[model samples]
Target: MDKFLLQQQVLDRLAEDLLQVEQALREAHETATHEENIAENKYDTLGLEAAYLATGQARRAEAIRQAMAHWRQFRPRPYDASQGIQLGALVCLVDAGGQQQHLFLGPDGGSMRLLSGTQLVQVISSEAPLGRAMLGKYEGDGVLIGVGSIRQQFEVLQVD
Candidate 1:
């Protein structure tokens, strides 16, 4: 894989997302304070619900904005093949059925499915269970992850 190409792709996607989120938040903030949104009766929850929804969206957008900033400022350094997985690492995991999945560890982009060419790249965080397990593990290493009642196994096939 071309690291430079992938980095640019991910960065572009995140930047676009940031713009859309900001615009939506701005529009919502404007409509949230219109006179029509004011409640006529104390028992009526329409205004309250509308206000809550706007506030919630604002908070969510704020979090994404902060994370997008981190992504923009992050400088991805080249890692040796032997090095453990960290930010900017593209990892390939193999399941029992020999199915392979590609995941890109990033500073911040949220959970997103991004397509570059014909491949789908999934953004993952170090806080995630599988992401945590991938740290410091070399090729041929196996890990078992359990979420709720399901247990899954994965083998580290490659890291680039």
Candidate 2:
């Protein structure tokens, strides 16, 4: 598949997911409010129930909001030399030991699946180690992760 087309598809999917998340959040908030009103007269379980529902809904809503923001920023654009390793780049990398890996930058919807020999590396979001390293970097640039004992290196082979 063409890289641009793939990126756009992923972006569209993320947008749709964001919409769903928003709708879910709204429903959750509404349910929590209704529960709060019902439990208002019953002080015994009111605190516990309201706390549980509110906390869960708030956490999920925050997570989805953060993901939506990240995906919005990573939306694809026309690749220019000046852009370096912006979002939507199909990055090819080789580890120091010569193992190859591929990363398709996109949202965190459990959608990244790339083949490395017989192994598959699942890319999640741009906030991950390798993803962060690749961001704003040009071809031939090297990123070092960790130090000494757990040290690893990745060399950017190509960006598209």
* Best of the candidates, lDDT: 1
| Each prediction's TM-score versus the true structure | 0.86, 0.55
Residue pairs in candidate 1 whose N, alpha carbon or C atoms collide under 3 angstroms: none
lDDT string for model 2 (8-51, tens) is 45556556666775676566556656644555455556545554
lDDT of 2 at 4: 48
Q: Candidate 2 lDDT (Cα, whole model)?
A: 0.66
Q: When superposed on Cα atoms, how far off is each prediction in RMSD?
A: 2.0, 5.3
What CA RMSD would candidate 1 show?
2.0
lDDT of 1 by residue, 8-122 (tens): 6766776777677667767666666777867788876665676677787778777777877777776766766667767778888999999999988776555676776788878
